[model samples]
Target chain A: MLSKKQARAFFLGGTLVTFLIFIGLTIYSFSKGNDQSNHENITESVVRGKKIWESNNCMGCHTLLGEGAYYAPELTKVIDRLNMKYNGQGEEVIKSILMSPVPWQPNGRKMVAYEMTEQEAEDVVEFFRWIGEIDLNGFDRIVSPLAKEDNNN
Target chain B: MKYKSQKVAYWFFALSMLLLVLQLVYGFVMGFARIGFDNLHEFVPFNTARAVHTNLLVVWLLSGFMGAAYYIIPEEAQRELVNVKLAYVQLISLAVVGVVAVVGFHFNYWEGRKFLEIPRPLDFLVVINVLLFLGLILVTLFKGKRRTTTALVLSMGLLFAALLYLPGMLPFDSQVMDSFFRWWVVHLWVEGVWELIMGGILSFLLIKLTGVDREVIEKWLYVIVGLTFLSGVLGTGHHYYYIGVNKIWLIVGGIFSALEPLAFLAMALFAVNMYRKGEKKHPNKLALYWTLGAAIVSFVGAGLLGFAHTLPQTNLYTHGTLVTAMHAHLAFWGAYGMIVLAIISYSLPNMTGRKLYLTPRGRAAFWLSNIGMIGMTVAFGVAGVAQVYLERKFGMDFMLVQKEISIHFVVLIICASVFTTGIIMYIIEFYKHGRPTDEAMEVSIQ
Candidate 1:
């Protein structure tokens, strides 16, 4: 084993290298994604819809991007579920549900009745659709040795 | 308590205990509501109760850390606190701001962010309060005769924790950007800077209780701190995995966060090794237990359980499930929570000149709380695995899955009661220690 002084040097050097790599990767990742693209693919509604999502504090219950409270369903794939539930009238179904005054779950934890206009409902749906389009690379792929160990544990 | 100024730590600890009780009360309120006891639904919703429960937890822990600093820094530096009056001012203002912020949550006068829910105006007040605390701490350390590694590391942790809060305070239009920085505050605090504070406090306690050489113990502190930064700084990306951020976080966050446990494992090994190496057994065995407990349990909770979900594969299924809660409860309780209690156990006897450390109540408090928390972890774990299967994999209705998991909350409530009872007994032992006095300062712990 090296001396304690050597260990100190190695530790410091290792930390600096890892920290720099983390920053470089993060910046590069953000730079690649067109987070703000006003094109035919992504409309202004997506941006407006994101603002609506934040203002409503929907994340307090529903998780978007696999973050936030675990109390409600994950919203990343909400459009898929709503579409199936509505028998192909997904947007209309979402808009109507937002208009409903009744709490989603009456007996258990209740959703607060936020007054969202029709346009807000449409924009929020558009926002959900936009997030859905963003490819989380190989979303459900299992490619790590950790996964095997995780399962065994 | 070798100085009169050390007595000021008593009030801060007292505040911590009070807020902790409030936090538990809100926990019960939410727990009850979760079981269809929706009487408080109109007034204290789950979201509100959650906000109250979690915010109170952070505040109380900070209060405990501040108290630990006040009590430890003076002795480490071989000097009294520089401004006892200002310290008191800091404590009172902190409590007031905390109270006002929690009260405002009921009126919806807060942001929608999970942990950073405190409104913008109150955030400024928090900044001022922390500045006052750091000023008192730094001035005293600078003016003293000694500047040990433990003291410097603890102060540095506190300093960085303060600076890191600024990024969260900035207004961001993008949810992705807002979340990006929120983790800087939340993730970095627990996994990064707070670990430093935890390390510093652990080293101090180990040195005091184990009667080890300061040099030997402080050397371990350097390694742990280095490992924490090496892993934790990049581990912040773990939360970025699916937050509409860079895909690069998937690789960087997964790889680094998996290594995050090394720091915690090092901490556990360090504490246990120090204990074995010690010849002079300090009388405060309860303190030793808590200190050692914090180290080992944090490894299992934060290191092992955190690794279980840190990877992109497992998290895709378990993210934001009760699985996350399973890891959260244990990690928080084991790492920061137990360390605070450890310092309190060590300081209480000296603070009041009472040898209440070895009481039957104290023993009960330790065993029951640990076992009870473990039971809670298992309960959450079982429910979480089931949740990931039925809700995520099976693609069942969310509400149906919640209904299925309601049984676990019953188990959770029972264990939480046991956990709360142990805390009550510990607080009672704390009470029997009485107030810090001049006599307390006379007896030399070192």
Candidate 2:
């Protein structure tokens, strides 16, 4: 038997309260001590790399920090992952792929190769490194190569 | 079709249909790419195709919502649109911006943020286009004799949606910060304001289709949207949990997101109950099917499937995998897509003065599209769950896991073909209805 006035009040009041709380939570999450986003660690190179990443729409294919199209590999732990698989030549491998003129087709899935300069490749690698370092509240464990099953097969 | 200005909605809907077809083409491109038949790799790369597909979905849905507003506002407010010519200008500008953004994706001229990929300059154009749309809608509603709750809620939803878009335009050097605000635009619009739009439209449709009392329908509309913002505003945390944000989001998002399904549940129950209570049976059976289908299917798709992966623990495994895709495909289709189609189905016959109700083709379109989309959702779910286990849990190579799950994509393609056939029939029906005539305005069905 809720009246129309009560329903309208409920709608308006509930929306206002929840929205206010949401804003408070957002501000608190990004405040000085509560900040876990590694804002201080974001260098010029990381910004440049992000620009390149955005310009190329790398996220259309590859995931970074567990957000993207799911078409390509997640690059959150790419540095650590590559270093493990390529005998510490992970940086070189990434650089080579980025600098390669042709598409990088590993496992028959083609990546649009940028044929970047060494400097550009280095910037991207730095971006990955920065991304890998941030504490993801245990999400990094899943992305880490060490978390894989023991069976090579 | 009580007013001549309502006919303008027809053009906006036509544009929506055109964009939807283009969106499906890009969808097929991505589906084929997943299965390694990426022949269009050089021309329409996966990223390009993805950007086009998602952006197109946004545009078509926006177009449909705009069309619905144009049609519904005049009727609910008891007046013609304040300026029909300005409305047309808004429609054309919207189409032009959408086309340019889609075309720009092909040439690497994009801002490249997953959902918000249109470059900054084009974002301004979108803002201007939306401003014009809101101005016309608001002006018409305020100038009209009545300002019903349904109309107010719909306009409010549109207004908030435009405001939310500003957050996505803000730049941040930190990728984490960029993502945090991006959800302000993406998550808030979908879970928050868009539900208002949906509720408004649902109430309007139920009022007309069910012959239910407007006051009763509008009262329940308030309750439904109340439940939406209650859970949904705080539910934005679900996206914040793993995106380099604080652990506070894990708890906040988990609890609030768990409550989010109640709103959708309320919507389904309300729609069904209204139907049962209705003494009058409107002739537009196809619209009723879609309206009821939207409510029920959104509950299963957006509410339940979303719940399946929304928990912080489960999301840790399924965050970027095909699991999200599973939930998204059905969610958008059931919630936004079906509603748009419902309004179109209801408005078309009235506008064109063609009472082609209960046609076999229309019924076929309904069943085929729903069944096919559900099949596609299942295919994505299977692939996504397998992906979570193999790639994330077992730590297999991404490409290796993709190869294992490629069969699901094949199944997806087959099901998508069925869905496309239904859509083709629906379009054929749309075509047969022909243009909205001012003559039809005299015979107001409602």
Candidate 3:
């Protein structure tokens, strides 16, 4: 029979230990050597593109790194996936869609047309490229078939 | 009902109901959009609707929890709220901030970070609002004669929840880091401290409704919340695994997250055992239904369904797909949503001096909502599993796979309609209870 005091101790002690360990794990994961996030590769364009992505709430519809509403396509490897599909015109296609005045409706599912400038579109493309390069513990292959197909080839 | 100040909770509950209705509306907007009737695309895009839906859920649940705190604290502490007027001010400010952020979303005036979409400026307002809420709650609890474990646990949960929100506000140039910290707030709040709030409320309800010994119930409450943080703190790894983080998360998240269900399972068993062991069953059948339903359904939804997709193997396929949505819906509904409603159900009759728990409509609301939500879950699961197959497994085009799964949305809409009817009935019952009267404190004692 666990006493009330014992139960309280268990709760407090367990929480403290786990929280400390969680913090330690977080530090370990984010350490330079363990970093899979491509920290050094992040350029000014990638940062600006991320800003546009957030300001526009691209994640509301499209998923990045497999996190989002699942309403639109996953854009983690959009550059690679698109380049493979569009004969290396993937960046142009993306920019065109971003710069298009009208909504981009693929199979009647409408994406809010951002109607961005060429510069802004290029920034977004840079963001996508940066995102595509990061190692995602093999999830990029799961999301972009091109990655998997390339591997198979 | 024991104190006049407890009536402040009624207004907060009203706010919660209002926001919950708005959440459902946004949910329908997204659902209808899925089936290609995106007529509101120009004014309210899918992203806007999604941000609204999720943010509304967070607001409503927070409001509900605040209301529960307002009601429960005074009783547990043996005193009226220190300043009822200030509490009302807190409520109004909270509502204003929620409304402003919601309206801002329509105009692209949001930060667009999924759940934390409120713009940076509005995030400050939220912090102020929550700080005021916590101040009122903490001041009232400490000012009172007694500080029970239930009160301390509930307040601690509230305090930690506010602290966790700060992480989401941190600026990150890396999308990966942004998501990593975002889960620190979202995942930790939902899976970690929120369970403490749930446990606290469940402990309070069990003591009152079951006539269970307070010490016994409080002891188990500690154990339940203990299990929660033990597994849940480390379980944040699940979100980290594929989000450009190190591979350590894959192993850590897989093992710890698998242990997460034990907490929920323990909650279910505790609630059921408490009920069986209860010698004096209070007459609030409606509250009991919600309380027990919350426990059982959470085990199945949060525990079992969550387990279904939580593994690294399965999550590798189902991460961003409808499968996550499938688990998310039932989990939030069963765990957070139902507990809020349970607290409301239990507190309402006492506050209004209305013994309307015997009404058939209340029972209808319970069954219809549960059944409809279950149908919706099944619909999502089938579509999600199908999506994993056609899209992720078979490498079909995203749009093409979506077309194959669009039929599920139709089923979802039907179930949603059923679910809406139940909620409407529940709200109507809520409305029928009328306002909380100070005199009911005396009336309910009889």
Q: What share of the true interface contacts does each candidate keep?
A: 0.36, 0.86, 0.90
Tell me how each candidate scores on DockQ against the true complex.
Answer: 0.31, 0.84, 0.92
Order of the predicted models by TM-score, top scorer first:
3, 2, 1
lDDT of 1 by residue, A57-117 (tens): 6666677767777776677656766666767687787787677777666345687665578
The superposed Cα distance between candidate 3 and the true structure at residue B198, in angstroms, equals 0.7
Give the DockQ (C-alpha) for candidate 2. Answer: 0.84
Which portions of model 1 miss their true places by more than 4 Å?
A1-12, A32-52, A119-123, A138-153
Tell me the tens digit of each residue's lDDT in model 3 across B1-446: 38989999999999999999999999999999999899999899999999999999999999999999999999998899988999999999999999999999999999989799999999999999899889988998988999999999999999999999999999999999999999999999999999999989999999898988899999999999999999999999999879899999999999999999999999999999999999986889999999999999988999999899898998999999998888889999999999999999999998998889858989999999999899999999999999999998888999999999999999999999999889989999999999898788667741
Task: State residue A94's C-alpha deviation in candidate 3, in Å.
Answer: 0.1
Restricted to chain B, the TM-score per model reads 0.99, 0.99, 0.99
Q: Residue B344: error of model 2 in Å? A: 0.4
DockQ of predicted candidate 1: 0.31
The DockQ-based CAPRI class assigned to model 3 is high
- What tens-digit string does per-residue lDDT give for candidate 1 at B235-348? 887887766666667887898899999999999999999999998789999999999999999999999999988898888778778899899999999999999999999988
What does candidate 2's lDDT look like per residue over A15-127, in tens digits?
99999999999899999999998888989999999899999999999999899999999999798889889998988999999999999999999999799999999999989
TM-score of each: 0.93, 0.98, 0.99
